[model samples]
Target: MESPLEPLLDGRTKGFPAAAGLLRLGQVGSMGWNVLAEDLPLPLAVLKETALRHNSAWMRAFQDLTGVALAPHGKTSMSPQLFRRQLDDGAWGITVATVQQLRVCRAYGVTRVLMANQLVGRQAITYVLDELARNPTFVFYALADSVAAVDALAAAAAVRRPGRSLDLLVECGVNGGRAGCRSLAAALAVARRIKAAEPYLRLAGVEGYEGSVPGPTPDQQERRIAEFVGFVGEVAECCADEGLFGADPVILSAGGSAYFDMVTSLPRQLGPRATQVVIRSGCYLTHDSDAYARAAVRMRERTPAIASLGEGLRDALEVWSYVQSTPEAGLAILTMGKRDVSHDLHLPYARVALRPGRDARPRQLPPDCEVTALNDQHAYLRTTEGADLAVGDMIGCAISHPCTTFDKWRFLPIVDDDYDVVDAVATYF
Candidate 1:
């Protein structure tokens, strides 16, 4: 298991073996050890290879079925290995949120990247232009939600005006949402402004995020998301009709792991233009147990085929820890906590419990088991069935909100179905 990422998984990394160079990242824990054998320390993050492959293929097939391309947002697992896998599996391009992430992608030999956010500072513009110039075949795109942003991007691109215009997309935003233009008029103006920039900036397409569309309930949210995505489609058509696009095969993208069904369904009437519709869904690469899990059900409800495909997306990421204490009858303290896993949307759910030689295989958690609370480095787990209670026992916990969980681990081990370490992946940030 002495892989290229061995240096990053040494003793310096959290939860790694304390003895430097004692074990490589992918080697079976020391002395033919397995997860159930407690060969590694507690609070270890592991990715199920089977689930990872399933989610990746599921998302790609979903995109192919909808007749769109995937530029999976790389911010979810900033792992170059995952990016390469996605690209190799037929991803059109990789999408990033910041210039720093852009650097990471480029460093890993990503030729095409879509910066899904606005390019603001002068240094960022210069870096992008310089990188573009360094590689003639490079295809990079940024978002522009306002005339001021377009102007700033234009001025910054002028620093390297190397006979090529910077590619950009007019971002359409919703009321009280994140970045982007709140009105069609405003977005259209931004597109026109990009066209006005002429040789310095190129209006390539339109961008939007349907994940946070406001609605009172699930049905209402889905309906409103459909409407908002339709608005983005209208904006794309408007930009195309007005001759605002700088080139052919315009890009129209709007998907954020949630409500991608709406993004694909509502934009079917894109005027039959030569456009490559892309969905920027990153979390589907490692589907979680909450938030996105509910969305997946909705996605399957909207499209029944996805549900029949290997249970949609299985939960891939898990944090394995041991029961540290059971001071109370129903409450037990786990070694894992906020520092070890994610608790943004929902707390971790117990999946399996093992007692070394006593159990031949991992067992599912009792129906009454639950992770109630978490401190900086402790998890308070409660179980109604007293038989499931004990200290020094191993438990595998499935995480929610994968985005928040990934940023906490720099190096994650990839394990097979039996939880044996097979390979490893390193995250940049």
Candidate 2:
């Protein structure tokens, strides 16, 4: 099926200057705007059409092999078009961070949403309950790590009396983690509280994010992820035995982008609770070229089944910037910087380069080419010997974390393998 380009969200958009006009959604790229050909403005983010479809299919295959449903974390892209694609391809639901993001998914007609984060504040809580009351088909669930949070949700639900029960997953956390209960016992206690909340709140199941587990070495990291993921299942079993888990098809979700493979094998151990294990690894949609690439390698190493798929996730996302100046030998300043791409996990990788009116195919960057520094609007590209780089050359950078990189763009053009802009998607950050 042909992908539909979302209509121009608004004329006054940033990054892509040509978007400011009365343009047809499916025909914006009719003139064949090529990233390498310099058709769009500089510092533009683009997704490779082939790679995106391949990544989505790869994830679905993983789900099929494991018998686990997918509620891909929507916070990674926050594009309703992507969410729709994920669902249409067999995702269980969309996972979002805040109520505001949930609203965006709802606006796009998503019936089921998993609020991976705890719903805090009266306003956010009120909004969720009101929506559930208004929409009969809406299936929403959130995390509760502490009794205080469960109490807040229960009180808010009681006040709203949406005639609907709020589903909650008892979040188990690793020590030194950001959210969730640090121990299995603590998580179970919160589950009991959720059950006690009665009609206001229902103990849906157990959820945790294994990405926060601390491991000094890769081996240690795998061990820790396994341990935490195991605990989540054990807690689910305990909750079921204790009658705390009242929601059927109990949720046993615990898969971040890095260690999802470890989390996917949890259903067999979760006992016969009629549970559904959800892998919420959102970054798999736009696999990174650096950090997550390394993680995927690790996944293939520890699990031979994944490596058997030949090439796993490909680099689907890239940002284009021009070489503004060659300040010194082996050093070039690029027009793209932190404001355009992600530098939090690691600096963007110098993947490919295109010289306008010269290179037809994008050439891979030199082995020693690296982006060492990034200012607000400039990237310092440092290359070693045998590096042939010139001014006015377009540098295509592969990012590390799709989560942070996406917030920098309001709109991203979906491009084909030949760098032709075929469709576009709006970002709701």
Candidate 3:
């Protein structure tokens, strides 16, 4: 049987073997394509099948240990295939940042979606309302930090009359942070506004993004995160006290890729409010090598519970590029650049390398070998003295931020430990 994703596999798709013409997505494994064997093109982004499964299971265990639900941010991969994997692994719902992402989830038969961002604009608002009216089982929640946003959503919901109330989470934020009310009083105001909107707009719960809260030191950051999460809980409690929350299990949603350990304390803070704590840690599915990895180490130190849980998330994503140029003695230019992998948080790290003919397996890149810079189509890999790297050698780099890397490719191959292509996932954005 032809796989539903077969249409996405063709000659034009990046990372796919160009000579293999119009193969079905399901037949990728049978093609015997191996990255080390040079069956596919260079600068290909692939997901390690083993690592992917490990990361998914690890997150499931974390959720079970913490007793907090996960609505992993969909913006991380934007791939419906991965969303299915997370849902099947027991995710509470998929979290999105925009109406477009929510649309993708809805199209793929995702019944529950939480838009962590405020729902604005005529077209975006109309789309959500249309989806709600069209599907009786569709459950949606969006953030609102101000009365203006609440009024706009209420106006749209009133006009559309989707026959169901538009659930909203009053966002609480800190100064100098991203969207959300900057003060507890402000958050209560938004919650009250959402409550006043009545049948049109429902104050389902309170939400915030602790990742944006700044601190100069790790301890300071963790302290601020705890304080910010406390504020989010306070908003939920105030809403409950005022009879503002419309949902039966008031949702207290927060937690970005970092600080989920602290965000999990929301349930404890709420005590017995009949609250549902949802952590939106999107990058946990395909853990990164840089920023997130460092954060994980700190997470274990602060939260002993996470430390007790065997091994944490492993890096599942990698971009393989060939040594295209050996321009200088200390530098090797790689085929992958800003267009292929993520360079937002940190430059991609050279993890492993395999020479075309000489090396039987991939060897660890020298500890000193670092990605110093990247251009539109090339990476400047700075190698230590006497590092055995040459043109045509395959270099696999682990990215820092999975969110930016996943957006660069429409389709990414899922490969086994030996780099054999086992499956493929298509990204919506």
lDDT of 2: 0.86
What TM-score would you give candidate 3 relative to the actual structure? 0.96
Model 3, range 1-429, lDDT digits (tens) per residue? 433244447778888877888876667878878889998887899999999999998998998898899999999999888999999999999999988898789878889999999899999999999889999999999999999999999898999999999999988888888888998788888888988999988888889899999999888988998999888887787778788877478888998988898988885444455888999999998999999999999889888878767998999999999999999889999998999999999999998899988998999988899999999999999997746999899999999999999999987889999888888888888
Cα lDDT for residue 296, candidate 2:
88
Score each candidate by Cα lDDT: 0.83, 0.86, 0.88
Instruction: Indicate which candidate wins on lDDT.
Output: 3
Candidate 2 backbone clash number: 0
Give candidate 2's root-mean-square deviation (CA, Å). Answer: 2.7
The candidate scoring highest on TM-score is: 3
**Model 1 over residues 1-429: C-alpha lDDT tens digits?**
333334346677765656545555545333353566665677889888999888888877787678888999999999888898899999999999999999989888899999999998877888998888888888999999989998888887777875688999999889867888888899999999999998999998899998778888889888888888888988988887788887568888988888776677545444555787888989988888888898887888877766556568888999999899989888889998999898889999987888766888888888679999999999998877654758888888988988888898877877788777777778888
Query: Stretches of candidate 3 above 4 Å error?
Result: 1-6, 268-272
Clash pairs, model 1 backbone: none
Q: What lDDT would candidate 1 get against the real structure?
A: 0.83
